[model samples]
Target: MAAHKIAHASYRGPSVVKEILYGISLGLLAGGLWKMHHWNNQRRTREFYDLLEKGEISVVVEEE
Candidate 1:
């Protein structure tokens, strides 16, 4: 039977500022995307509702 030896790993210093900056950047990107999606959805909803209100289009709802 052969025995295996495990090697020890070295520790590196941590950078708090770098981690914070990365988190902030990620948050900003996510927030911008969320805002863009929200704006687009709202615009579409408003347009559809406006069309409905103006009687420009008709919807047929079937009851089951």
Candidate 2:
């Protein structure tokens, strides 16, 4: 309708630069979090194996 055109005649959305920056920021945050999570899991696994080697932990297995 003509009313819809008149209402949005002067409306502007976000800039391209703003959109690019937002996307880059989001990507960096996600990548950093994923890296940290992977690093932590590796560290825990390493520590667990070291403890196991030192005989501080035990593993139980049963034969069927």
Candidate 3:
């Protein structure tokens, strides 16, 4: 039987820097998406209230 030799892998500094940059970019993308979602919700809420104030929509109130 013959024995085989295995080679070891080494880490490089540029790869580490690239990984850090990718993490930062992903974090920024998530934050941007969150901000956009919140902004859209606020805009929709404001429009709803405006329509209600203008009597464009009807609401039913009950007396207790």
Candidate 4:
């Protein structure tokens, strides 16, 4: 059998600045989403407590 040679493919794409900027923007977007979710959770918890104070909802506990 004869030996065969394979060529390596080296493809270059976007610039470093563009890639860095894209990464930064994605990070900021994810952070903002996480913050929004956290704030919403806090607001919901506050509202639940307010409802509890007003006796709009009740929790039943069983003791043995």
Candidate 5:
């Protein structure tokens, strides 16, 4: 059997600043989305409760 020769792998990765920037960008994007979802949910919940309080809508139970 012949001996197999091994090859060296030389690859340059991204810089620290580039990695940090990417991390910050992804974090900001996620935070913004989360905040937006939370705000929309809160607003909807408040509106629902307000409508209920104002007698605009109500829960109904029927006897069966």
Candidate 6:
């Protein structure tokens, strides 16, 4: 008796439009995250400065 061989279909990679869309979406997500981080940092800095101005926070410096 002869052994039977199994054949499988090969997979085709993603199309150009799919790849382009993926790249665009990834770029947008990265930009959004960067913007969020920048906004948060600015907000925190502003609050810290406000606290300092209001005497709610103190800083000490010593001469060496």
lDDT of each residue in 1-64, candidate 6, tens digit only: 9998889888898799999999999999999999999999999999999999998788876569
TM-score of each: 0.71, 0.72, 0.67, 0.68, 0.74, 0.72
Off by over 4 Å in 4: 1-13, 61-64
Mark the regions of model 5 whose C-alpha exceeds 4 Å error after superposition.
1-10, 62-64
Question: CA lDDT of each candidate?
Answer: 0.94, 0.91, 0.91, 0.93, 0.94, 0.94
Report the Cα RMSD per candidate: 6.6, 5.1, 3.8, 5.8, 5.3, 3.6
Query: Model 6 — TM-score against the truth?
Result: 0.72
C-alpha lDDT (0 to 100) for residue 9 of candidate 3? 89
In candidate 1 the C-alpha lDDT for residue 16 amounts to: 91
Which is the better candidate, 1 or 2, if ranked by TM-score?
2
Candidate 6 Cα errors over 4 Å, as ranges: 1-13, 61-64
lDDT of 5 at 19: 94
Clashing pairs in 1: none
When 2 and 3 are scored with TM-score, the better candidate is 2
Q: What shift in Å separates residue 12 of candidate 2 from its native position after superposition?
A: 2.2
Off by over 4 Å in 3: 1-14, 61-64
Per-residue lDDT over 1-64 for candidate 5, one digit per residue giving the tens place of the 0 to 100 score? 9999999897888799999999999999999999999999999999999999998898776579
TM-score of 2: 0.72
Full-model lDDT, candidate 4 = 0.93
